[model samples]
Target chain A: MNTKELVEQIYKKKSFLCIGLDVDLNKVPKHLLKLDDPIFEFNKAIIDATQHLAVAYKPNIAFYEAYGIKGWKSLEKTITYLNTNYPEVFTIADAKRGDIGNTSTMYAKAFFEDLQFDSITVAPYMGKDSVEPFLSFEDKHTILLALTSNQGAFDFQTKKIEGKELYKNVIEISKSYHNAQNLMYVVGATKAEYLSEIRGIIPDSFLLVPGVGAQGGNLQEVCKYGINDQVGLLINSSRGIIYASDAEDYAQAAANKALELQKQMEEILLFKK
Target chain B: MNTKELVEQIYKKKSFLCIGLDVDLNKVPKHLLKLDDPIFEFNKAIIDATQHLAVAYKPNIAFYEAYGIKGWKSLEKTITYLNTNYPEVFTIADAKRGDIGNTSTMYAKAFFEDLQFDSITVAPYMGKDSVEPFLSFEDKHTILLALTSNQGAFDFQTKKIEGKELYKNVIEISKSYHNAQNLMYVVGATKAEYLSEIRGIIPDSFLLVPGVGAQGGNLQEVCKYGINDQVGLLINSSRGIIYASDAEDYAQAAANKALELQKQMEEILLFKK
Candidate 1:
């Protein structure tokens, strides 16, 4: 799906929201454990509760892969559930997978073909061959990790390459690659201050942002700098939303948290309009 | 096992051979496809055939993961076969997973604890917090992707961060994180020319060299520049070995390929001493 179409839907719905399904087994509602598949149970409730308010749902694959086969099945169930019930919601496999050319092609098939995720997160360390294969999918999107919110982000991301932050250079040079429009980036909300600068470099591209809620990133600041003419942001809150409470009513609590973010996002979109 | 002890074993065996099990479903033998679990059958035969000739057996997760639940089960069976039958043979998940702090911890658990891989490949783009989680596991190794052999590897890797190549800086800085001693790097053999430069930064650490066979990496060039005093190289060949022949003789062809690499590696190890 073209990002402009997503933005158009966002404006029509008056919400610029994305709910992150980073379901952790230990942290999920204890009552849900009684179900045969706790991960799918937890995700279904959250998706049912918040689907109307969100434009997308980002599922971090590590959470599912942790439980091994059972976890992956739960992931498949969750995606199938979404497709069957909430097909309008965009799906992102937050799997930071990158490798040699042939290997990367298999990964593209894993997410895009086997799992049917709308987008997949990729690391740009291996350069064009590793990432271009992912971007080649005419209908799919590749979310490259540019500047993250982690402490080690400063380790090499900000390193100056020819008088520019390595990340800045990455965005500039990555633009030159063929089929660049399919490439978005991950700019963490905790590092929202860099959004103004990031937007200045690549103004039109969408950003799949994490670190908004439990990480204590102020949503307003991220919207202020990260939003574009099309309202280009998918703010993800994992712990803050999905783990809102461990009580039996955790789903509703998650819905409440999602509603809070959705309301704020609506206001931002209104302001932009 | 300590890195030095592992190196000693490789030296005594006169081989730094790591047979790569990047199994392609289509390349699997037709006879095995009749088995209840074809991929597992294929992997078991290959592992059994070449376990002695190789010091390590790296099963790239993508090939198996592309098959969905069956693929994951195949991966589990592959690792289980490796651990149960040949425990001394080091196992690598070849899953380049890295994310934020808590997420990274879960990924570390997925591969290292849950699956019990001796090592897991990690992408270093998210910085130290993402990578440190993987390194924190006791005795388990985390092989970070360094200079890869693909065209895109030049995209962000060779970009000078503060006037030094990003790959070099990643090695230099990652060397200082907690439990960094358990760290290794994935330096593709196709990029063998830069191996000496990589070794200069982290001379004593192990390098998991891929891209040798089907990817056109020269083994001689890799050994000449990449090998250190410790004989610390785990050169991997996937398609060249595992998929050498797609017929019933596939595993036998795999054994021959592994033997060829081992023979060459033995000569290199002797020449170095």
Candidate 2:
């Protein structure tokens, strides 16, 4: 999925919220857990209840993968459900995978061709060779990890190199790679103040902003700095939305949380215009 | 697997070769394509033929993933075959997966717990949050991509910021992360000249060296500069070894290639001791 289409989807829906399905099997309700594929069942309920409130549905691949092939199958089922039921909602495989050239090709095939995720999150440490392989796939988005939300990001990402921060240099040098047109990035909501500087580097690319809600990053703070003319931010809420309730009304509670995010994003969209 | 155990296996077998299964289905023997799972069939045959000659097997995850669930299952089967038959041979899930703190936890589960891979390749873009998650897994090795064989590696990996190359900084910074003892690195054999410099930075960590065969990287030169007291190198040869022939004799041909590498490694061991 290209930046323009993602932007269009957000504008059309008047929402920039990307609902994150970072589900944990042990935490899932016992009723659903009884099923053959409890993870997929829970995801199906969440997707059904909250699809209208989301412009994108981001599934952190690790959660499903923890269940082994069962988890991978659930991931497959979840994507299949999204494709079949809510085709309009953009799908992000929150799979931060990066490797060598040949290996990246296979990852591209898994996410783009096999599993059919609209976008796959990538770690850009291996440089352009690891990244370009993902970018080479037509219209498939490769979301680079730029400035992450966690505290440890300050360790190396924000480290002062010559006169510049490594994170800043990463963003600048990444722009020079071929076919980087489909690239977006993860610039955390916690680090919202840097949006202006980050935007200057990659003005048009959408940013997958996490660290809102459960992470204590304010939506207003993120929207203030992150929202571009295209509403260029996918502010994600994973634990805050998916685990809003463990009761029978879990899906409904998820919808409520998702709706709150959608409402906030709608206001941000209004201000951006 | 732990470093000492891996070293002992290498010494006992008289080989330091980790045959890379960067297999593409289209590149495999045509006759095998008729099987229900050609990829697994090809891998099983190769493993059976060469397990005695090689102390380790590195299956690049991308190749299996390209085929989707089938590809992943093939990987599981390949690992299962190795574990059941040749329990001592180190198994590497050549999946270079690294992400933000929360997400990296999931990725660690995906490969280490779910798939039962002994080792996984990781990207170090988001610094500690991304890499620390993979390292947290007890006893499992996380091979971070340091220097690679491809042309595009020079794009960002070699970019100088503070008079130090990005790869150097990555290795130095990564060394400080918690539970870093299990960390190895992917240093391309083609860049053998930098092997000594890399060894200087990381004198202890095993270097998983690729680009050794068809990519024209010199094995002898890599050994000269990269080898440590422990023979701290897992020299990988993929296409040139496994696909040495396209006929039914493909597995035997792989064995021949592996034996050739084992013979060289044996000679190198003599020089070391």
Candidate 3:
């Protein structure tokens, strides 16, 4: 989906929330396990319950990959269902993939062409050529890692490079690449204060902010500093929303959690207006 | 495979040549396309032909992942073939993967538990927690990206951080993580001059050196500076060796290319001995 369409969806839904499908068998409802494809079934139920509450869905690729071929099949099914049923919602493959040019092209093909995700997370460690392949795809987004939520983010990302944080340099340098317009960024909500500094670098680019609920990032603080004219922020919530309950009303409980976020987002959008 | 087994294999084969199974349908022989699983058929043929010449095989995961489910199935089959037939040859999943702690654990399970590769490449962008889970696995090696061969390596890796190169800091810092003994590094062959400086930091850890023939890296130069007491270098050749020919005798031609590398490796090991 184009930036305009994504913005329109945010306005239409009153939320820029992106639900994370980081499914783990141990975390899902016990009753779902009896189903033939529990992962897909769990995702299907969650989507059914909360598709309207969010404008995007980011499926962490590792969750599916851990299950092997069976996991891959479930991923394929989940994506197909999303595309078929709710084509308006933007889909992001939280895969964190990047490599040398030719190898990266294959990855672009894997996520963009084959699995058909609207966007994929890319690690900027490999630099220009590693990231440009994904950017080259028409209408597809490449969410580059800026400042992640993990404690590990401080280890290298925030380190001073040329007297500025490496991530700041990443945001600055990446802008001059082949198709910089297609780029979005992964800026963790835990570092909500940094978002103001980050916005100064790439004011227009959408930032996929994870770490809102389970990771203890304040949504109000994130929106206070992260909001743009086009609602250029995709706040993601995973475990706190999806694993809200393990009973038969698991999907309903997920919707309730999603509704809470969506309601907060609605107020944030109202304040912006 | 343990460190001792890997070192023994390098000595036994007299070659640390790592053949890259980066299969592309367009590059393989036309006849192979007739098979039910062309990628697997090609990999099988190449493995059958060159199992004796090379001490290791590094299958670039992107090539297989590009084809979607079929690609993953081919990857499963290729790794299965390698483990079943040539159990002695060390396998590296050239999947440069790393994520949050829990997500990273899932990736470890994907490549190490399900895929069963001896080692897997990891990007250091996420730092310690992202890397430790992979290293936690017994006997499994994590080949961290330090100084990549691509032009992009100069983009951030060579930049100054605390008066030292970022990649240098990566090497120095990674050593302090848990199971640092299980860590290896990916140092591009293109920067052979930097290998001397890298060796000064961690002399014992293995270095998986790519960019040999097609990327124009010289094998002799990489060995001159990068080699350790354990013959701690796995020189990878992908396009130059795997896609040696596009005709009916493609596998045979690939073997011939691999033989040339194995011969060069043997000479390097002989001098070391």
Candidate 4:
């Protein structure tokens, strides 16, 4: 899906929420383990429960990869299900993958062509050549890691390079890449205060903001600075929503948690209008 | 495997030559495609042919991931083959993965525990928390990307951060991480000049050097500055070695190419002694 369709979905749903499918079997309900594919089942239930409240689903690839071939199978099933069931919801492969030019092209094909995710998160450490391969795919967005939500973001990202923060330099430099209109960014919600400066650099580009409830990032503060005319912010909540309750009503409980955040997003959108 | 074991293997083989198994189907022999698992069969042939000459094997994860589940199955079978047969050879998963603390742990588990690689390359843009999890794994090495072989390395890696280059800062900061002894660094052969300054920070840490032949890096030039008492470098050659020929004699051709590099590495080690 392109930026226009994503924005349309956000407006239609009254929520720019992106549910994170960072599924860990240890954290899921005990009953689900009896199923043939517990991970896919858990994700199917959660996606069904909260599809209305979310415009996107960002599946953390690490969670699936940890399970090996079985994990890859589950991931394939999950992506297939999403595309077949709810093609309108934007899908993000939270695979922070980047490499040398040719190698990166292989990765781009893996996520964008084979798995069929609308977008895949990419690490910017390897710089232009590492990232441009993903950008070459038309209509497929490459969400570059700008200022991450984690504590480690301060280690190198916030460090000054040529008298400016490295993340800002990343944002500024990435804009000049080939077919850069397909670029989006991963800006951590934990650093909401930095959104204004980030917005100054790429005001129109979409920012997939993770780290809300469980990570102590306030939704109001994130929306206060992050919202654009098109509402170019995907506030992601993983543990806070999906792991709300591990009982049989776990899906409903997840929906309830999502409802709370969606209501806040709805109010914010209404107020902005 | 521990650092001691890796160094021992390097000396025993008299070659720190790391064969890169970046098997692209397009480049492989036409006959291999007729096999049920061409990728695995290709890797098995290359490993069997070149196992005596090379001390390490680095499988580029992107190549495997590109094929989806079948690719992952090939990867699993290839790794299993290596571990079961050539148990003495060191393995490196050229995944270049990193994320937040918890997510990084999952990735570490995927590569180190599930995949059972002796070492895995990780990007350092996320800094301490992203990398320390990989370090925590006993005997498993975390090769952090310092100066990559690609042209994009000049984009941000060479930029001055706090008066020192970003790669140097990465080396310096990473040393303070927990279980820093398990940390190795990825210093591309293209930037052999940067190896001296990098050696100044972590002399004992192994450097996984790619870009030897196909990318125009010299073994002797790299050895001059990068070599330590243990001959701390794993010189990787992917296309130059593995894709040497695409005929029925592909395995023998690959072995011949690997033998040339192994001979060069032997000369470097002798000269150093």
Ranking by DockQ: 4, 3, 1, 2
Give the per-residue lDDT digits (tens) of candidate 1, residues B1-273. 567667766976677888877877677887787788888888889888887788888888888888999999989988887888887778888998888888899989999888889999999888999999898888799999888777778777887766788898889988889999999999988888888888788888899998898889999999999888888899988888888888888889989998998899988887887
State TM-scores per candidate: 0.97, 0.96, 0.99, 0.99
* Candidate 4 RMSD computed on C-alpha atoms after optimal superposition onto the true structure: 0.7
Which CAPRI level is candidate 4? high
Model 1's DockQ?
A: 0.84
In model 2, what is the error at residue B124, expressed in angstroms? 1.3
For each candidate in the order shown, give its overall lDDT on alpha carbons. 0.86, 0.85, 0.94, 0.94
lDDT of 3 at B14: 84
DockQ of predictions, in order shown: 0.84, 0.62, 0.87, 0.91
Error of 4 at A186 (Å): 0.8
1 against 2, candidate with superior TM-score: 1
Which has the greatest DockQ?
4
Candidate 4 residue lDDT tens string, B70-115: 9999999999999999999999999999999999999999999998
Q: In model 3, where do residues sit more than 4 Å from their true spots?
A: none
State each candidate's chain A TM-score.
Answer: 0.97, 0.97, 0.99, 0.99
Q: Mark the regions of model 2 whose C-alpha exceeds 4 Å error after superposition.
A: A160-162
Task: Give the winner by lDDT: 2 or 3.
Answer: 3
